[model samples]
Target: MAAAAAELLSDEGYRADGRRPDELRKVRARMGVFAQADGSAYLEQGNTKVLAVVYGPHETRGPRSKALPDRALVNCQCSTAAFSSGERRRRPHGDRPASELALHLKQTFEAAILTHLFPRSQIDIYVQILQADGGNYCACVNAATLAVMDAGIAMRDYVCASTAGLAEDTPLADLSSPEEAAGGPRLVLALLPAAGQIALVQLSARLHQERLETALEAAGRACRALHAVLDRVVRERLREVAALLGD
Candidate 1:
């Protein structure tokens, strides 16, 4: 495993994909990607791509039994397409991994959204992974953040997410699939940048106690960087809409 991880970084301090250890992959995003949905966004982080759509802040569907009296219900579903990963998946949803990701997304967004303002209602966030490389959850969170913003829902702050891995005692940010497959300890973080608050943190594999702080710090920095990117995308989208309305 160490050998695989060592190969991830070249002698020149670049990853096999030619990225510096601390650098993130190219991020491309657009808001209001779907007109019919209340809000929608598409995002690509390197080879990973995801689309998120938001609906509601309206009356709860299904049964009132599921409704929360004091705050809005946040329903989230995260799924990967059959061809998203290298190996084709037989089922897209309701599986263990997908269900777990859905729950994580719900918890992350609940921390940032102002649910109390829309009591007895529900907000549905649906995210689909069209392509998978690494950092699928991070990509989903970032995409969902844009979708929520486009919906004009009240949020405490933007939720930005990123993944970090530890290799040879050095912390690496924004890991790609190859880097992730190298069997290193990985840390994922979702942050509310403006408030300097962490919405979610997930650690996979195991790392020495001494390395935990460094990994967390690296993930936080990456999340902040991602927030900057998402902010720019939102501003650009708003400008385009303004121009269209003016015409």
Candidate 2:
């Protein structure tokens, strides 16, 4: 029994996806994916793909009672496409998991955005998982952060998110679906890389107190790595705009 338990994740220290422990999958992204929205971005992390669109810093909708006096209200709606994962998710909307994830996204951005500047207004963020390889929450947050920045929203810092899973003593970064299914406890983090503040942290299950630090360190390292890629995407987007204006 002890030998089997020790070998649960002992595949020569490599993940099923051929990723070494603490390694992240390829990160690719594009900003301004849609001309209609105030801001939009498409991001792909390995096999997982997500799209994010942002509208406003404009007047609050519906009721005036919903507007905040001191800061802008962040409204977030997150969903998974029925076609994602080569399967159907009938009635993905309004489900408990979807609603909870959307709430988490709302909270994450609210903490990062400088809402006081747009008092009485609202920023609407819509993010959809077009493909779900794993780590859907982190991908949504990463894509939305780009959308918000492309919209020229004021934020204290870039919000980068990543997930970590501990397999025995090994910490795997940027979990893929296979890794997630491996049944190890997982940790997700939304962090402000520049400000050194954590916007959100979630653990799928309890982990050993001693292992928690390593898992956190692995996730935090992945977030910073993602931040670098996101930053480059933003800069390239700016250069493209500048070129268009010059032409």
Candidate 3:
């Protein structure tokens, strides 16, 4: 429908970023990035970068009515840098989309966290996107998982997330911004990797019924791969902490 436009997928089936259909972007992450917070982590997936910080299993503040009787209340906030991307020049935080993302973050963690252990308490997760190449939500979830771990919070399992998009019958793993803008079918999935449980699934655009599983499986595989990267980051952080303590 357009002239002089770069294809989302090249003739050889490689994405614009030159990744294979099932290959994820390079993932790099660090845990305990902030000493003041209960837990903090910074993560980068390709060019999408996010920071997450966790504060408190502390007593709930404000209205007693807001406290959950059976589990700790999970509060989440998400913010994106005004200049995170090429065209995003204004503040997007606190808007409708940001609020919805915050809600999703809250829900994603609620399923993974052993919230019952901290009943009547509050756990706050703050996620900030420092860069916005694509897959913002997935990056946020992965960063938050590491942050929660850094805080020593108990969770049912490690939460990992990834996004996939279907292009011309090929399901692309870890959709980049350009791929997402192509307006094809996209799937976002968050998983408790060890439990083989899906914490969240978000689909955008219409995908064939038969292809849904393919897209989901692609996303799941990417999530499992992320689990390995996150696990490595956490372990490396622990070793660093242990070394400092030993010294």
**Candidate achieving the largest TM-score:** 1
Q: Report the Cα lDDT for candidate 3.
A: 0.90
lDDT at position 240, candidate 3: 97
List runs of model 2 lying over 4 Å from the truth. 1-11
TM-score of each: 0.97, 0.95, 0.95
- Find the candidate with the highest lDDT and give its number: 1
Q: 131-209 in candidate 1: lDDT tens per residue?
A: 9999999999999999999999999999999999887877899999888888788999999999899999989877777
Per-residue lDDT tens digits for candidate 3, residues 102-190, read 99999999999999999999999999999999999999999999999999999999999999877766778998888888877789999
Candidate 2 weakest ten by summed lDDT: 1-10
Flag clash pairs in model 1.
none
Sorting all predicted structures by TM-score, with the top scorer first, yields 1, 3, 2
Q: Candidates' lDDT values, in order?
A: 0.92, 0.90, 0.90
**Candidate 1: which stretches are off by over 4 Å?**
none
Error of 2 at 89 (Å): 2.2
Against the hidden true structure, what lDDT does model 1 obtain? 0.92
Separately for all candidates shown, the number of backbone clashes (residues 3 or more apart, or on different chains) is: 0, 0, 0
Question: In candidate 3, how many Å is residue 92 off?
Answer: 3.8
